[model samples]
Target: MNLILLYPEEVQASGQILSLKDRRFQHIAQIHQPQIGDRLRAGLINGPIGEVEVLALSASEVQLRWHLAAAKPSPDALPLELVMALPRPKMLKRVLQTAATLGVKSLWLIHSYRVDKSYWSTPVLSPDSVHEHLCLGLEQAGDTLLPQVHLRKRFKPFVEDELPALVAGRRALVAHPYQAQDCPAPAWQPSVLVLGPEGGFIPYEIAKLQEAGVESVSLGSRILRVETALPVLLTRLFPLR
Candidate 1:
């Protein structure tokens, strides 16, 4: 974990003091091995980045006094939205974590013909699981803002009824392998990118997305796994800026 993320409930009655007794404590105990008065980089979820002075430490728990360092502004999130056709259950977890780490503020997990119906029933779809993976991403990137994840099991309704407004006045693109326009250079404008499942969107699905004002774009001739394509697409569209 690049940053020790703390939630509001962890704060003591004084607000400045925090008590950790979960996996975070184990991390401090095993990985950091910090001592009393040692300072660690810490941040409040959805709040400012700062440091925590270790007041007490042990294997089961640790107490730290929160200290918000002035002049250290929390990084701004990317002005982007990712609308992806839900992938396999295993891949979904990794995708969610990557999304959060990359600073995608809005994530739409939608259904497509290529998506397996059974994948939707996985336990990872639960709020707790999704939040956990997103937190892992935030902690990795030293970020605090959790990306908003939306699920749409019905593909047509989301594309026909709700997508137009989402893509309106923004650069909207959907990944397609055949006869698609080449992906564009990175621009710091609000954008919505739709990535398909493993085999990719069916012809009908692509048409539906096209009708919703989403232009089909291609990465290359080589077909890439959803996991590989995501980071590549996002990188090409919006770099390390």
Candidate 2:
């Protein structure tokens, strides 16, 4: 980990000493290889960005003195919310990390007709695993904010019930391979972009999403994996520069 992360509860009195005994200790000792008095950027999960001075280390734990000033705000909010088909465990980890890096404000992992049912049972869906990936992404970009993630196990009900409220005034685009418009330029208003499974959205799924006011759109004629297509969509829709 480039930067160490702590939750609000981890910060001790005087706000100077923070004890880390979790995976972060291993990352610092083995990966970062910091010596005593080595200062590293650190932050609370939903709180502030600050600096930590390494005070001591052992095989399984590290102690640091923290100095927090102000928390860093997110770079920018994409006018986009991602509603994606559940990808495999490995891909899910990568996508969640990338989405956090890209400043996606919200993510909905929904079941789709083509999605593998087994993907829902992955341990990666646990709170700690998800937080780990988000922290990695945040550290990658020197960011402090975390994205909100939602899980939807039923495709039709999500499209019919939860989706309408989320997309009411926002432009909604569904990425499909055929007979759809191209992804649009980022506008002043927020948007919601839906992506399909590895095999793409089935007809009924597409129809239901459309019925809920999601417009069909495409990256191109060529198909891309969910991981590849997500970053492309984020970059295309919200060009950084």
Candidate 3:
């Protein structure tokens, strides 16, 4: 990993000391091959960027001491938010990682008519697993800020009860492949884009989203998987910014 992440508990009275027994230890020892006194970039989750010196190493673990560095710059204040239909477990990991890499500020794992109920119960939904995926994204992009992720289990209530406030004062677009206008390229204002499941949104779901101020948009005639569609949509919607 580019910037090794540390937990709050890992920080010692002497500053930050991470146990090499952690997964990151393996990453460093195997991939990075850092030597004692060697410095590496590191960060606390949702916190500052800093440097860590490899102080000691062993067969079982490694020890690190951190030197406080400048606080990481805040991520861009993009108006774009993603409300994505829950994909399969494997795809979920990729989606979260990709979204994190692209600098999405917030992500909602949304439920829709086409979504499989079982997907929500996957172990990948656990906080630790989610954080792992996000960490990979951060390392890939050399970014330290973590995106906020929200899970919506009920489709109708989320749409009828919560979506309005979430979309307040911003444009909302729902991506569906059938009978919709083309998806617009990224614009200057903040926008909330809702993507449907692999099979696409049902008519009733689309109607409810529209009632909640979402405009239906298409990504041309060819239907794409949720993973493929998400990056394409984000790039198109936020090309220059």
Candidate 4:
């Protein structure tokens, strides 16, 4: 982990001291193996990035002094919302982590025609499981702001009832292979990116998205997997300076 993520609740009652005994402790004890006076890069979830001075360290737990006054704000979040067809469980884990790492503040995982019904029943979708993977992503990126993930089980209802408002004033683009315009210039403004399932969205679904104000766009002739397409599209939509 590039940044040691500390939750607000984990802080001691004094607020300036924090203690960790979870996997983070294991990581620090094993990987960092720092002396008592050493400081480590750390951030509070949805808070600031700063250093934590090791006050005490042991096999069971590690105590640190939180330097909130010296902390800096986390990186600005991308002004984009990612709407994606829920991939299978295995791919879902990677997608969640990648989305978080890329600074996507909002995510919608919806059903698509090609999406397997069995995929919904996987344990990876559980709240705890999702939080863990997202944290992994945040730790990798040294970011603290957690992305909000919305789940939609019904495709038609989501498109017809909810999607229009979601894309009302934002530039919405749905990635499709057939008869699609090339991905537009890097959009720094508020936008929505819709990605389809393994085989891509069916014609009717694409039409529905179009009706909802999501224009069809393509990432060239080479069709990519959902996991591969997501980061590529996001990077193109909002490239880092």
Candidate 5:
């Protein structure tokens, strides 16, 4: 893990010292093999980046004191919301982590024509599982801000009623291979990107999205999996500032 993420409740009464005896402690003890007085990169969830000095270590736990007063600023969050068709159980885990790692602050998981009904019942959608994967992503990127996820189970109601307003005043785009404009140049602007399921959105769905102010865009002839396409579309739309 690039950063040891500490939760708000982990703070001791002094507000400076925190302890870990969970997976994080195991990761530190096994991966880092830290020494007393050695400092490691850390940050508070949705807070600033800082260093935590190792005060004590044991096989089961570790105690750390933060220098939060001198903490650095966290990375800038992306001004984008990802609206994706819920993938299968396995892909869902990766997607959550990938989206969080890439700084997507908002996500709307929606239903599409090709999406399997069984996919919705997966345990990966549980609050705990989602939170865990997102944390893993944050740890990988040394990020602290957690992304918000929304679920829309009905396709028609969401597209016809809610989507237009969501896309309004934003650079909204739907990634479709057919009859689509080439993806636009990278720019830092508020945007909403709609992605489809494995076989892509049906023509009728694309039309509904277009009517809702979402322009269809393409990344050329090669069809990419959802995992590959997400990062490409995000980077192509908004490069690092």
Candidate 6:
């Protein structure tokens, strides 16, 4: 982990020595192997970025002084919200991590006709599982804020009822293979991007999104997997950010 991420509840009081015994402790002992007086980069989730000075180390735990006075604001997240058709369980884990690492502050995982209903029942969708994946991403990026994930299991109701409100007054784009315009250039404006499953969204789904004010955009001739398409799309959409 590039940054040690601690939640508020983990540290009961400020200015006190904190002990870590979780995966972070294992990482410090095995990977970092720092001597006393050495400081490691650390951050509090949704809080500040700083460091922890090693006070002592043992097999069971590592004690550190939480010198967070130098803590600064976390890096800004991308000014975009992602709307995606949920992929299978295995792909979901990687997608979640990539989205978080790339600074997507909000994610909407919804159902499309091609999406398998069984995929929703996977343990990866559980709150703990999602948090674990997101934390891994934050640690990799040295970021403090956790991305929000919204689940919508119904396709028709979500597109017709909720999506319009979600995209109101925002530049919305839906990735499609046919009848699509070239993807727009990256900008700082607020935007909502909708992408589809492994095979891409069905025609009717695209139509509904278009009716809801989302324009259709294309990547290319070749179809891409959900995992591959997501990072590619996000990077293209916010290339400079």
Predictions in order: lDDT: 0.87, 0.83, 0.82, 0.89, 0.91, 0.88
Per-residue alpha-carbon lDDT of candidate 2 for residues 1-241, written as tens digits (9 for 90 to 100): 5557777787853356867887888888888788899888887777767788899998889999887764455466677779999999999999999988777768999998787899999999999899889888877766677888999999888999999988898988898877798788855568888989898889988889889999988798788888899888777776673
Question: Between the candidate structures 2 and 3, which one is better when assessed by TM-score?
Answer: 2
Please give, for residues 26-141, the per-residue lDDT of candidate 4 as tens digits.
98999999899888888888877888888999879999887765577777799888899999999999999999998988999999999999999999999999999999999888
Question: How many angstroms is residue 63 displaced in model 5 relative to the true structure, after the best TM-score fit?
Answer: 1.2
For residues 32-73, write the lDDT of model 3, one tens digit per residue. 898799988877667667778899988779888877754465
Report clash pairs, candidate 5. none
Q: Candidate 5 residues 27-122, lDDT tens each?
A: 999999999999998988987788889999987899999877557877889998799999999999999999999999999999999999999989
Model 6 TM-score, all chains together:
0.95
**How far in Å is the alpha carbon of 206 misplaced in model 3?**
0.9
Tens digits of per-residue lDDT for model 1 on 1-241? 8889888676533338878899888888888898789888888777777888899986578999888753155566887879999988999999999988888889999999988999999999999999999998998888888789999999999999999999998899998988799999988788999999988899999999999999999899888998888889888888576
Best by TM-score: 5
Pick the winner on TM-score between candidates 3 and 5: 5
Clash totals in order: 0, 1, 3, 0, 0, 0
Would you estimate the TM-scores of all the predictions?
A: 0.95, 0.90, 0.89, 0.95, 0.96, 0.95
Model 6 pairs in collision: none
Instruction: Give the backbone clash total of model 6.
Output: 0
**Once superposed on the true structure, which residue ranges of model 1 sit more than 4 Å away at CA?**
12-15
- C-alpha RMSD values across all candidates: 1.6, 2.1, 2.3, 1.5, 1.3, 1.4
